[model samples]
Target: MDAPPTEAEVRDRLPAGAAPFAGRRTELAALATAAARTVPGRGRLVVLAGRPGSGRTSLAVQYARSVAADHPDGLLFARMSAPDGSPVPPGRAARRLLEQLDAVPAGLLPADPAAEDPACAALRTALAGRKLLVLLDEVREGAQLLPLLTEEPGCLVLATTAGPLTGIDAIDPVILGGLDQGAAVDLLGELIGGTRISCDPVGAADLAEACTSRPAALRLVAGRLRADARASVTDAAAELAPAVPAAAPQAPKSRGATKPRGRGPAADRRQARELLPAEPVPVADTDPLVAAFGLVYRSLPAPAARMLRMLTLAPTQTADLRTASALVGCPAPEAGTVLEKLAALELLEREPAAADGTERYRVPGRLYPRLVELRSEQDRPAEVELARARLLERLVRLVDSARLLLDRTAGGNPDPLPGPLRLRTPAQAAGWLAEERDQLLDAVRDAIGQGDLDGSAGRLVTALLRALPLTGAAAPADLYQLHELVLRVAERQQAPRRAAAALLNLGDLQAAEGHWPQAEEQYRAALDRARAAGDEPACARALEGTAGCHRALGDPVRAADWYGRALALRQSLGEPRAEARLLVRTAEAHTAQRRFDEAGREYRAAVAVLRRLGEEEAAAALSQALERLRRLVDGEGIVQVSE
Candidate 1:
């Protein structure tokens, strides 16, 4: 499963190492004082609220790390919302938290809805009296934090939100305004060097003011300065001056009042107009952080600039070189250079490189909105849609390529993509699928949501669904949702074959969850769609699903009948593996009906097929079952179903 990043991963995203956090002393002291004053019964909730890029998350992480020893149990972190600004369902959030605490196994699915939330219950029990610190970042609302809150006074809850988390009880909010000038300059000094700031203290102060004392804005300015060693603070400030709002024009003298100035108001107004930028900047454009973003954006070369605009359409939260390359229709080497340049400019945050040495980058949460706005303002609708289409097509081919390499049942070699994307081995293929699981899900959403009713979206989603087991990346509920999404897309496209495949996938999930009736309903629906499409393989799959559901529901006769039909279909299709699997199912159904002789015959047939297919392990297992069945029949002993 793609669990939330561990504490170490979260720390990597924080402003640590070379980019030291230089401000928030008062806030840290406040948190420390609060910890010192903790009462016995109830816990303390300190919410760090601020605008995007105001350093709320960084401060929280810094404070948590400083006091790690105080919470010997653990310091856990959970993002209350996804990077795409969607609130994570509380149940899912609870599961992630519990996994972090090692209270539940990773990738464990939730209990049945009819039962209580075992995940949340287990979390509460596990955290009942521990001296733990929970950092909840990107919290969207007060209610979103409730499920994750604990009542122990020994525990400390530090939550970060874009705005005030109102209506929560006993809440202590540390609203993070812009940094003080000294602190902002200190941050600049840290980025560059104190010697540079000492040389032109006035310019450093002016630059801080121009950046509105926002840490993120300062970082951008500092990044630019560091990249060009000869660039001074004054130079950076002047470059950003156009984005800063000019002082409001003095009100015109009243009609009755006489002008006593040396130069008339008209001349002054004309001169001021000439001094202003040719293009009018919006109110939001006046924001220092936004201005800094614009400054960095305008400095980009044409290809990098266009790639920045199209990056908002990237389905993944963090993009690797392949995704970046596909977004701009560029080669991998060119895309890598562009990505590194953006990272240097602080336009994107560079994540640790993947094990395969693929460079990854993300549009910082605070910067993403501005990037999206730029896409809307600079790129035409057609251009944006083309980028979106290219990205989706790239994702489809990559996923299909990975699936082909992983699942032998998925016949045919992957085509279209060049050598780099053709995942060579099963391990490599599965790892790629797992790493990009969420991105794949988001791509499916994008594919369908973009009004592609021509079955392309369904095909993309189906490709991912077929590879779900090999990846084992998604939780059962998430997989179920994706299947439903694919089903809807298939139905809208009037693609019966795709719809049947989606239905069978849904049926398998339901059966795994022990919902026999629901599983049967999905299987029956799939059977109808398969018949309508005259898709024999899909029909066989649906038959197999229905047979399993019937067997689960204790209808052995129906199970045996359906299994026989599915087995016949597989045999006719020359699918030896599928035939062997159905034979085993048929043997189980016969054993359930107390037909020991028939069960032994079916087991023997399955063993022969397994051995012919070089499946030694399966053949040996089935051979043992066949011998056991013979002994049971000869001695008139009890017939037990195979494990």
Candidate 2:
């Protein structure tokens, strides 16, 4: 019997990392149960269906992990896409599956990539006998994946997607409604703080209702208020009062026929409905979330309402009075006044900032998500596009400005980042990003989702990744999600240039996080894309990155292959300084693999390069390598050098 892929192996199988989403226990359970029928000779394909922010992708991932122990073969996940609204060919998804199975695919191998049938054949054949877990995340519909479903035993198929997979009636299908009342509250409790919930029962209850019990809504709301030390639960609840109602989705039309009424949890719902009302209320009459936001939007002064719509112009924490005013074509003072009103209404919060006079505001706790949802509802595609262009225009400028500041600073600067743009130190940069990083990322994501296909995501992602390394205060989950988002955005655009850069950055994160094989894959993918795009500089960077990954994996020979490429690329680009630095790194790899002669020559070359560049620090770095190589030749060894 062939060995099954381990959890580590299955994880590394993913081309890009996974984004972390909260609250989808019900959806996940449905997928797991559907997939549980896989036997030695018989298997089933289970489709997870939901709309945007419905938590389908998250559920499929969770189910795959939960059942990993039972099906040792491994898990393969893919996001399928095609031209127009046509289903992606099964062959394309199959190739992705094979790639995840540790099979180094030749290239983008899709013949009739618009057809699901042919694509599924390749995947079905690949799964002949070995146990495998396949997750088709975020597809157009179930029929697109129908061909990929295998009859072979020992294989589990998990298909998570947006909307009802109408044609998949023959198979098990579970529609994810909004989270239940109890679970939604529990999730909010976990995110917001048990103490706060306990102290202000009404506030907590109100917040839960305002969030519509949607996991994403609840988490978003909880995360916002958690930062306000002075925030009372009731105050926060009141802020989200428009969104406040109840946790559960309004009953399904079918369920309404059979289900009882007036048995819902009764608590301080009015206060909970304050924050967000952007997400569509599918059960408008029955859902408290709809009631909450409906009231908020209705009550707003027309100027404020118009301004609220215009806020699609602002990035999460970067929204200052000036930007708001400029975007809305109003004066700064006018915008400031409106901003305070939004805050008073619990629609925004001004975070504590340094001495810089610039102040920053976020959508009141989780209510901001509604703004995004609301933005998407414009009936006219032209209007939506127009709004997107305006928003991204402002974002492009903001990120460009931020990038200038990032480039000027080396490690530390005492003057401080001006205003609410608080990146004082590397650590502070990381902490600030970690704290508000999700909101920022969500803003960027909204930009892409609404089709901001220009190089805008590239710059925004650059700012994000640059900020990531410095933040030690963020959760691992948040860090990884950022990585996942960057990868997704780059890939979706099919812009290999951007993809390669994001891959290198993501590999750095993975390597740092102890995911070496995965890091190596990212590095290799980056190297391939860079070379293909004829981006010599990026190629060299990727090569160097791959070498570092190899060194971490204790594979000096492979490390040498990558480093040698980096050195050649640097040399070709006329960067003698960079060439020398890589040479020195190559020498260290040699020492690690116990190759003394080669190590010695590499060190000498590095020293020569450092002297030419007048890099005293780098020249000093070679001393330890010199000593180590000499010691190795004399039956001694190398010493660790500080960076």
Candidate 3:
């Protein structure tokens, strides 16, 4: 498996060390002291918690690099959260650590629960005596760090998260805030050159405060200034000022209400001029961060802006050309062109090509919230809905088509898609599904929340459920959640047929997981809905599911009856394939009861149907079963039944 970045690689990825480190000196010193401390039985754990783009990651990396020589054994780094805002599984994190340490052979880690514990224990033992530095970045939960923490006294662990990791012993928590005024100015000087700062010292200070001294916001401002040397610091500050909403004047005090004194308009205007003399008064109802994003966003072409808004639909804030094309309803090449332009503007970071040779890009996490806000503000709710519908429709169709190519038994493909879509081979289909699973799941939830599932959302859910078994990308819990979302949407829309389908899917999933009672309950509910809606196909499906549940629960008599009913329905509906399958199932139920004669007759009937349908594989298997049953009945001196 491909490993995440190593300690040195992570450090190298940080903002340039040569750039002046202006702030967080105290926090850095404390972190360094913690990392330097060692005990006999306890390892050091230091967590830096702060908001997005608050320089938590930068500070952690800087501290680690500054004290890199303290631990001579090795430095390991792992990102404990995915780019899509999901926590990485503890097992995977542990496996990666073991791989990095060379404690286990590559590809030898077993996924089985019984075998995983021993593997983890062995890895911990391997690290028992080593003096190492482990950097876990972007940790969303403490459990994600449990597998990586060692009892080795000489080891040091430094982690960064959006919030504090509570319930951990001996944790030194540092809450990183914005840079102070002087430090923010110094950082700007380092990026924009000292000469520019000296030319307008007051303007530089104003720019720092205008950006709220957030390192990320400051960096964006600096990048803009750096790109255009002719652009003054005051000009940059003016561009960012609109992000700061003006304070609304307080209303006059009533008998019991108190009103605070405020500065006069003239004084306020004076202060504003000192801050950014070139800019107009800031408007209310705007976020500074969003304002900063707007400055950069407005610089792009219309297509790029449109693409940025469309990109918000991606939960992970990351995409390749294929997903981008689907979201934007454009050709892959055009989507690629827009992505490159965004990358050039630093709106999106271009990642290295994945193993499958597909280039991926990530929208900076700091900008995700603002992008969403912008989308909501710029695009109407209906327009957003339409765009989302198109995206879901395309993804559903694509995945459905891919599954058909991969599994001939997967049933019919979806209706013809409008645009030119890429069709992957069986081998590629699995990889594609895995890559897009998170996005698809997120889209499903979003559609449900927006009450826009009547068209493509329901179809996407159905297609995804069908594709999951073939790809194995989603866990059973994830499937359950998706189905539950579908169920809610179906009920909300008063669509009985959709509701029945969702119930049947839920029942099938529960049966696969050995929850027979729960599965039966769902199947019964589905049956009722199917009957109410007069949907024969759904009715047959529900009946078949109930039969399977009964069979699994050791009630073959009931299973045979239910299967018989389903078989009759399929035959009446002219569904030859479904009828043959139900016959095989019903025969198995009879075989379990030692009714060999009945089982043999059903097997022969199924084989004939399958042979006529040109299903060679199924027909051959049934024929062999029929032969075995015939011999068993002959040896037992049982009467043969004629079909």
TM-score of candidate 1 on Cα atoms, chains taken together: 0.73
Candidate with best lDDT: 1
Q: lDDT of all predictions, in order shown?
A: 0.74, 0.60, 0.72
- Tell me the tens digit of each residue's lDDT in model 1 across 114-216: 6544556566667888878888878998777776666777778888898777657666677777777677777899988899988967667667766777788
Give TM per candidate: 0.73, 0.45, 0.63
Which is better, 2 or 3, measured by TM-score?
3
**Model 1 lDDT-worst window of ten:** 266-275
Error of 2 at 159 (Å): 29
Which rank order by TM-score, best down to worst? Answer: 1, 3, 2
lDDT per residue as tens, model 3, 107-223: 222323343434456557767887667777789887777766777877778888998776566676788877776777778898779999988776776676666777777776676
Candidate 1 residue spans exceeding 4 A from truth: 1-18, 34-45, 70-76, 82-84, 91-133, 150-157, 228-231, 235-279, 282-285, 400-430, 453-463, 466-468, 471-474, 527-643
Spell out the clash pairs found in candidate 3. Answer: none
Clash totals for all models, in order?
A: 0, 32, 0
